[model samples]
Target: MESDKIIESILNDFNSFNIDDIPNIDLYMDQVTTYLNNKFEGSKRNDDDKLLTKTMINNYAKSRLLPPPEKKKYSKDHLILLMMIFYLKNIISINDIDTALSPLIKDYFNDGNNSLEEIFKLFIQYMKDTDDNQSIIDAYVKSNEYFSNLDNEDNKEYLQTLTLIATLTYECLSRKMIIEKLIDSLPKEENSKDKSDKNKSDKNKTDK
Candidate 1:
């Protein structure tokens, strides 16, 4: 009665889902820390460095978003979501990041939500359609449930960064899903060999 099982069954029944859509989550997450370090390259953003400032952390919590590890700490599991955020910042409303992050945060990065995979699938579709659209700013802005608590102009940059970080959170989630689906698509040598041998033996038996 697992949720993915239910979804897989439905996809199989309707022929809308393919083996290509399944994901290998564990392998993808394992590489996140290293990938993040490369983004910083020579910069020293250690995992223990507490990349998120106190205000940033509070903003994420209030907006129900997540901040990634800075220098040393990083989570590959969250990489896809981070990438999506980066994509959004350039094309969509730079102010509504907290809204995009809500889905991942609420679903625990889509780890085990009953509808996690479906939501991820939806988000991917959304990205594909709107990732580069001009109305992206409006659509994204209207999508937010967060009414900012800020009244000071000095906090604009802080808010913008928070939004950017939230978008990153989303990128991590989406990228992770894509990676998992790609991994799941790989054929298993053992299973393929077993099936091939069985077919050969059955052919021999029929010939006899």
Candidate 2:
């Protein structure tokens, strides 16, 4: 499919789970994977495009991107965290994901007030209000059109690919800069101190 057509189709059918849409019951590893796959079915380009794998889940836990599951079952909060990591990892490093999500996990992991699910819902709604998908489609369409006009028929595909790459580069970098600023603005005494303590603990374990 042409890039513009693909973008239009994806935007037209863009769908994500609302807070209420997520399963409330604690799910085992396989179930969690299946649920996430189902939620992302519309976005997948092919059957091989798996959203979550057992190895990935284990790696997330090992890297502290996800809190450890209880008795091999993932709670609603864990699922939400995984969902956040899925999207953020596409544009940022795991370290950045840790920095961005640490405070939220600390404050609201299992607590009823200001829960992760609630925050996720708010973010989804905010994205919807901002018409982010439309913005993406417009950007892709504009870039594609701009590149199409150049008199290089032989290099048209290459130029179109470059245009998409340029668009993605700008979008990723712009968003990353804002995210870095936000991370820097977080309360240093709390987050920084916690990070230092964790590092010390890890080093001690390594030395042991």
Candidate 3:
């Protein structure tokens, strides 16, 4: 399929979980897997694809990408963390995700004020309001226009594919560099505290 058409189809059928749609009660590992699978059903490439797995959740906790579940039950905070990781892992490193989200999680993971749930809801609303799909279409259109001078009609599709790949890679690299610079600008003490607390929390969970 043409890239633009595929992108349009995705935007038309984009499905994501709302804050109210997530369950209020804590869920066991299997339930968490089931919930994520259902929420991501529309985006899956195949019917047999698994959205989340027990092993992956365990790895996330072990890597400190997410907080440890209480009593083997995941809370809404955990769910929110997982959702953030799910989207980000495609384009960013796990270490970068840790650095980017550590402050938010440290301050708001379990707090009533400025909670992660609220933040997640805000993001959902922002996405709903944003013309991201149109922006993507415009970008693709502009890129094709810029490359329209290619006279070889037979290889136009191949060249267009290469151009798209190069453009997307450059875009990702630019954003990643900016994010890394911002992360480096954060106070060293704050980063240290976050790592220390994460280690302490992980150890306490293991010792229990």
Candidate 4:
């Protein structure tokens, strides 16, 4: 059997989460583990992990990454950071997770509670600038192209979103919706080349 040692080592980092920050696993580990296992596997080793020593825990309060506790008491926040490390090392290609986490950390510090809006917005910005999201989209499209089964065509959500876009599009062209805002929501000109492409969606909801 292939050893699960590497996987355990990577996961072992998350187990050191401060008990104070995360009261219980039920309170916090919602998407963190899912994000972790989705990114890290038992096998692949990239050059990046060379420096990502097991002696680390994400200390968001101090705005720093430091050595893990001796006994390894896990918390939800720490696990979230572990999930981020997995993404930085494997999925998303940014030099470090500390910088990648800064914006989210900044926003949470400002509000005392993290906002999903700011988090995803930062993610979108990163993906757009760093080719992360685009690569994921491309990979998904490629996967769909090759997979034998994917014909469960549900255009309801697609059509509804499209309807909203059409409404916005019609209004924009007719001088009702703001062109600048509509442009922000519209698909990129190059990406929108295939006008008939069903999967490509443009979303723009304007004030009526």
Candidate 5:
């Protein structure tokens, strides 16, 4: 099918940000946004869509999803974290992103021996290794086959579309469940610990 060919070709040439494209020197806000915008231009649903903006970056920093930039300039590690945030924001909440990645930032954000760059490279390699284009093709085939017994020509198109939407939604939700479970497994943040301590203190005071 034409869609099968298109999906295969697109997945075969799936693009991801290259680590080498990151400059050694730090970047100002404009440069960071421009670089990401250019790199992910093709992924935009609309031509005028902005993937990353200064306001969004600032908000991320404020929300602690991104580490603060040094002297208003972002480092390579900052870019790497932003890249991760960009990819995950579409699938998960910003708070969840922080829960999932804050530990990494605390432990390995600046660890030269265990850098975020190395992790990013490994993740990109994993995507390449796990490219399963056939599964997607099968999904489309299944969507097309749904409601084949329905003889109403007018309802057939709508029913097939509904089946496809349902199938995709199921797949997305199933994967989201796994991701949320992994996030749930991460160590509680210091703030959460502090809150727990505060609650315990309050309880003790009430008992006294």
Candidate 6:
């Protein structure tokens, strides 16, 4: 019953925050950090933990995982990218993030057929559509059902917790593998060719 209540609470909070909530105005670095910290406060393990900091933002910029701010101010698009990067960094290495996001950044940063907001909105929708909340609840229920006949309550509880942890870990690992494969499947040379073509087009326009 406690687990059910906790799970329901988590599920209820899931969609409380959305990408549309990000501010449209360009923000200074301090403003960006404050906004992120406030927006992702629920993600923090403790009150003292900050979700984002100036130093982390600077490192991300230096790593080129984030596009440089215009006149030292970050746009809405920048915030979208940072939000993605924040979630991604927990699962994958920074280098992998750069590799995976290269195409997205090239096509949608600042200017593109689809705005970054639209793309991110679609992504969130897809996730929401695909996630099965019932499956999670079922897993928790099954964990409790297991080892029900065991005489030792302490051992039963420990095993049940371990079972739940293992289940979640396996699911995370499976998804991580899929992400790695998707990153590998991304076009490596096409990005360079596209850049070259754009450069040539600009040159021709300038000449004319």
For lDDT, the strongest prediction is 6
lDDT of 2: 0.80
| Candidate number that wins on TM-score, 3 or 6 | 6
TM-score of 6: 0.82
TM-score of each: 0.29, 0.77, 0.76, 0.29, 0.77, 0.82
**Per-model C-alpha RMSD:** 20.5, 4.4, 4.8, 20.0, 5.4, 5.2
Worst 10 residues of 6 by lDDT: 187-196
**Each candidate: what lDDT?**
0.46, 0.80, 0.80, 0.40, 0.80, 0.84
What residue runs in model 2 are displaced by over 4 Å at the alpha carbon?
42-50, 144-161, 189-208
lDDT of 1 by residue, 1-208 (tens): 2323433453343333222333344323235434433443323335555322345333433333454444433343344455455445444443344444544554566366454445556766764556343333433343332434557644644564456457656866786667556545654233333656889999999999
Error of 6 at 30 (Å): 1.3
Indicate which candidate wins on TM-score. Answer: 6
Q: Which tens-of-lDDT digit does each residue in 1-208 have in candidate 6?
A: 2556667777766667588789989999999998998877767767898688999999888766788899999999999999999989989888778888888888999885769889999988987888777778888889999878889988887887778779978988998999989888877644443666889999999999
- Estimate, for each residue in 15-56, the C-alpha lDDT of model 4 and write its tens digit: 332224423343223343343443344334663443232323
Please give, for residues 67-126, the per-residue lDDT of candidate 2 as tens digits: 889999999999899888888887778777788888788888988777777788889888
What local lDDT does model 1 show for residue 108?
61
lDDT head-to-head 2 vs 6, winner:
6
Residue-pair clashes, model 2: 0
**Quick one: how many clashes does candidate 1 have?**
26
How would you encode candidate 5's per-residue C-alpha lDDT over 1-208 as one tens digit per residue? 2445555556654544467988888999999998888766666778988899999999988766787898999999998898888889989998898898877888888687888888888988887677655567677778668767788966876776666667778988999999999998888876444656889999999999
